[model samples]
Target: MERKLVLQRVVIVISIISLLFGSSPVFAELNTDQLRATFEDNSILFSNNSEDTNCSPNAAQRAGDAAGELVGEDNLKKAFNYFISKGAPKFVAAAIVGNLYQESKGNPILRQNKGSEPNPLKAGGKYHPWNPSKPAGMGDAWGIAQWDPGVAVLYWQQQAGVQGDVTSLEVQLAIVWWQLQNLAPTSRKNVLAEMTASGNVNEATSIMVKKFFGAGIPRTDIRAAYANKAMSWEPDPSIAAAAASGAATNCSDDSGGGGGTISEGGLNEEQAKKFMMNYGENKNNESQKAMGGYLWNNCNGGGSNCVSFSVFFLNKFTSTKGVYTPGNGEAVVSYLRSNRRVPTGKTPKVGAIFSWNGGRYGHTGVVLGIHGDTVIVGQASCSGPGKGRGDGTQSGGGSGFIRVGKINETKAWLGRLPDEFAYPEVDMSAVANYVGASTGGGGGNVAL
Candidate 1:
């Protein structure tokens, strides 16, 4: 009886200990398992919601669902709004979202050695450089929507005040908007409309899949997989007609009255100026760096200082204007005169180029809001390392900016390179036509 009592006590003690300690994976909660499950379920849900007759739940829906899970509905809406505000055609955005759905199913996966899963991280070690096969993990590619590191870097640098890591989910949504703005249209709304007008969802899906993915994946499978899911998207009414008309669908001039408008091709004179103001506020600079960063990063291919910013902005605004290569100074000048002309002093509009050196090339920047004598300029630059290294006006050897024809508190002498430099008169209509041809692939048409 004494031995039995001892055994029973020992058993009770062990039971108590077991109850107190549970064993499981330490990081299960953060591993994103719950999100994965929810994503799978939503794919089926969306597939069933398609209005098109031929729409059926399949691989496309699965792909879209996976992609959707990465972005979520709320983020998706925000991304759509961003592109819409930037003058992206609704259909083009739809197509891009669809393409992303197909590629990696919204997972940020890049192939290194060859196309394979469970790839190791390239940047797992401190000295590692980026490689497609090996993922950097977490901050490398963090959501359903995926973007290149260069783009992610740019997004974080530009968007200020929003606290949190760029790898976080919320930041991914904002970056998605930026990604959509970058893509050139593969298909326009008219093409999709024409296909759908004949009442063939399968046909439309097949064509889009082929264009983006090529023969890598079978068309039938891609169409069936996404048929039902893709049909559920309802194009925003404001952009539906324009999309159908085969308008260039990407970041363009904003349509607000006070500032310039951006078309799908890029910003108009008014819109370009507004972009500067927005860029300035985001960069948190009260002086030339803001302008410099815009000019240099936009123009030159180097750092995000004044010179490169201008180069990038102008290149974006005028797609025909070649990039500022090391020996292409003369070429850049010729393009500016023949293809890209700026506004006159009388007009003094935003985005006008203040040329000097007898049209041999002086400097350029988007004119921010003009207030009396102070002409706000977004000068691009090639800043060196330091706190205020690349701010626009700290000129010597590095690229910078200066206001011509006037000097004040906001404006300073641009060293007076010359008095009356020639300004080219580029045809806006021709530029628009060039944009239409370059994007949307030859014939301009798309479908959602």
Candidate 2:
């Protein structure tokens, strides 16, 4: 009788759980206002009323021509004309706008959903946040030019001096225009220089044009456009004047730690010892401060701070003090290349160091879990997650898997975790903090 009673209770509990978790959700989808706001974050504008064929097919070429009407043309032209007043060439300005349009779909105000599908790293499965129904991806890559989150934020801060909720598409759009006006360069010589440096000027220019439109426009046509506007178009002498003249500024939370923040949950024995040692000697006994300093000075910047967070973590985990010998970043990269083992796609267990962009440090993230080609990872602030790059948002942080183990030259290395690390024992706080914290919270916690 007791067994039957227990069984009945179990059934009731199961039924309740099903009812609570199974269907008929109560949360509502975003309304139009929210949708508009989201789109507003990732969009841009440009035009081509110029005689130069290069400037002809600006944002208006594809966006306006397709819609059979002008889209952000007046605003774009005004901004272009303003650049001209500032000595920017009209042709050069059009070319700049063309680049933006190709990159950003010419919306000038759209949101990039960081949680959106086809995760760039190609992580399998969609991101399942606590609120499953919440929107995925962060926001669209806004403007006529599609700048990533980091670049976008840099442009915004440099130009508009605006910072706020990164998720707000409206703010992102404003930043987009501000970036075009103030942060973007307008030197025809510089443009030509960049084209020439790419090995094939025609090919490079063609790529730019293709990026703007769906193709069919030839390089010759694009060059003609450029030529028409080249001389007639004035140069914007102060294209980047805003950034140069602005106060000391920082964009994209720049904490060397990934995402916008750092979490110091995982520490091997040696790492813990080093943390204690650093704190034991520092004037400020705060572990957080020490960790933050370490990230900024040693591990976060381009060259000096280029050591992989995990490499530093391992050195500290092993109680190795000051593994960060002063030298070019190449030495550290070489060390990782030599010491780290590779993970075959078929069997990528946890604790693997993954390199991207052909070992160029184009981007790096730690593999938290692996299943087939899909990999779950924790990425740092390699780029911005929303429209306005530096706007503090957790979208830039936290744990998400990507499918990168499948690619070649993309190698993974296995590291020794402390004996204390059991399944579910790995300290993912850094990973979590990276994927969850905003730019303001960029504290390097692994070393701590």
Candidate 3:
């Protein structure tokens, strides 16, 4: 009886150990044969485009001509071959080609309109001739993939070493690959692995559309059809075989720890709201000495006072002590990046530090809230209406009053605070006294 009891006790301990350290379940690789069969079954659901209509007699030549009109047949083939050479599956390359076709019909130099310049990176204003001397950011998208010429031009120049004209097919393709490899390496790896495993043009196209294109257009059916068309365009057999054999080589590793995960532990929503409300009330107090200058110091200019404001917020709310405060807005971005605090995407959340490149000093703000496409921010700057909380677009001018602004008109990067930081309980009577002492005249009265 004693031996049986001991045996039962040992079995329970072993079961508990297994539960604690068992391996996670692994998903099976998709079967290529099944994917092909499914695609064949769904062929009738695909759109009947020009490629489908002219599939006879000189089918190969006609298909080549169609691709040529967009980016030239040779360039299209080159992009496919390049992807395969880099160990990406042929299906993955085909998926990208499908998206490119939809974006510009394969034309590398295509602009939003017929006569506009290929480079859209110009100063924010009316579209005009390419000055080459002034800053870019004028019009809509341009290039083979219809990229925002303003932003795309900078990346192409700096990353790819492409100079002079920014409309070259080769340069655009390079930028595309660069973005996939760098911007979201984990997503890229997953897409590549899935495409290689399945060898399904349609599924690969869908993944690229969602992950790479940011869902710019809602034409998944059309994109799937295009991917099928691209797959029919044959590539060199040797390149395809090499790509298949080297499937283990990912274009890039997730060394930066997948860009999507925000650092854990910070102010929760309720705590953030409480802090902002207090901060806003303090901001409206004209008698407060900090209102006249940046963070209680009299430093007025066209430059932004965001760094000072951000530092004050961090010092007051979190347990962080003696935080380095840079006056320049761009410098603040550098500081956050150095600390590994930059968030992954442009989407704004409450408590995010928003940064943008605006002239010499740039601009920075703390996100108050995000509603649909607009982000509400608290900031100090020369461009918006002077001082006091507004939406994201308000200007701070020379006086260093806290202001709120609306930020859907421009692009901004975000930096998140370390997760371990949280709001601490502090006395609020000082803030109430500051507001009560205000003469009701000095604070900037910028309205939304």
Candidate 4:
């Protein structure tokens, strides 16, 4: 009993510490049980929502829940807003609430290792910080959704799969969203349809148990109660759309990964910085998908090359859109010059839309930072990581599937670089915000 109490205190302390760390993993603070649950790589992106938007935490605290007192306001709000942002209806979000509460009591970092139920968490000692650096043995379930069969780690942690704590509330929820939308086998995907079919919270709860969990239904009543409580926070329509369309970027602070917006037409330094910082932070698969939807709907950017990518950024972060002509990437530069939307420059500046006319199709990338000789640029192609290829192509140069590549970033310098860069009057950053050490798959410290 004393040990349980001690762990509970530890849980509270960790929660406060996590808040202080802001989107960074506090895995080193974990006891074995906690550490066992973590495995991460930034293959997909989901912004943090440590603070619930549109609604405040319900004051009716459920103190004895998972992770002890830390479960109530923080985790619940984070989980609900996260699912909702991914276009889940309230009940769909609520259903996830029902299932997760039953699975791990809303704890994003909960771990239960290879053991039959009744006495889960047998792998309590299996979490040696070094273990996650390798493949997890079969049967361990980790994180909020309880991703099972330790092998799931292979999928969860892509490039960094060998190691890391990708278990921020957003990352865990992104895992759930990724599973439901793309990764889950057919049966699990059906739950997304079924849950969205009706607002019947109880029915949705049952559906999650049978369809998503693939287990005998248990604790439907308690799970339903949690689901009901989750629905308490009314969501905002615009924010939901933005969350569904684009990955979160707090253009204002970049304090930690969470939902921050550019407020549409308020484009300038914030717009360029948001683009640069977010790409630096992640620029992963789902980041492409979520942001791809925005790129498509707004700028007609569903193509397979540089033109589509640059146009998407322009139509999105800039005030208005014009000249979304279809063709090789260089044509975009000509159109911009003809329209006089941006001034041409030889030296690359942070937030400049660079145009390379050397290649047949030409190429384009957005400048994020300047490290003296090298300009850190975010680019996309049906061929690179800044997000040009895969299924994320739909129309002229605007929207679709979502793929990112380029094994390593392509580097360029001032004198010869792209020859031309286009940016409104926005000076994203005169100096490097990515100086010393950094975190995130995209690198350095920036907002969520």
The lDDT for every candidate, in the order shown, is 0.32, 0.29, 0.40, 0.42
Cα-based lDDT at residue 8, candidate 3: 22
Could you say which candidate leads in lDDT?
4
Q: Write the per-residue lDDT of candidate 4 for residues 1-448, one digit (tens) a residue.
A: 0112221222111110110122334532333333333321211111112232211111221110112111224676667766665545566677787788888776655667332332112322121122234323344576666655422432333211112344555555655654553234223322454454333677778877766777554778888888887777665444455343322211122211112221111112233344433432334543344235444333223333455556655654444255365356565655665675454544444345667676556777655433213334455555432323322222213222221222123343211246565654331121123222211112222211
TM per model? 0.28, 0.25, 0.34, 0.34
Rank candidates, lDDT, best first: 4, 3, 1, 2
lDDT of 2 by residue, 146-263 (tens): 3433223322332243334332333343443333322332211112212211223234345344432223433445443543443343334443443222111111111111211111
Please give the lDDT score at residue 169 for candidate 4. 57
Question: Candidate 1: misplaced stretches above 4 Å?
Answer: 1-82, 103-142, 146-162, 165-169, 179-232, 235-448
Q: How far out, in Å, is residue 156 in model 1?
A: 6.3
Off by over 4 Å in 4: 1-72, 113-138, 157-164, 185-187, 236-448
Comparing 1 with 3 on lDDT, the higher-scoring candidate is 3
TM-score of 4: 0.34
Superposed Cα deviation of residue 225, candidate 3 (Å)? 0.8
Error of 3 at 80 (Å): 2.4
Please provide, for model 1 over 36-71, each residue's C-alpha lDDT reduced to its tens digit, 9 standing for 90 to 100: 232222110111112122211222111112122222
The alpha-carbon deviation from the true structure for residue 263 of candidate 4, after best TM-score superposition, in angstroms, is: 28
Please estimate how well model 4 matches the true structure, expressed as its whole-model Cα lDDT.
0.42
When summed lDDT is taken over every stretch of 10 residues in candidate 4, the lowest stretch is 11-20
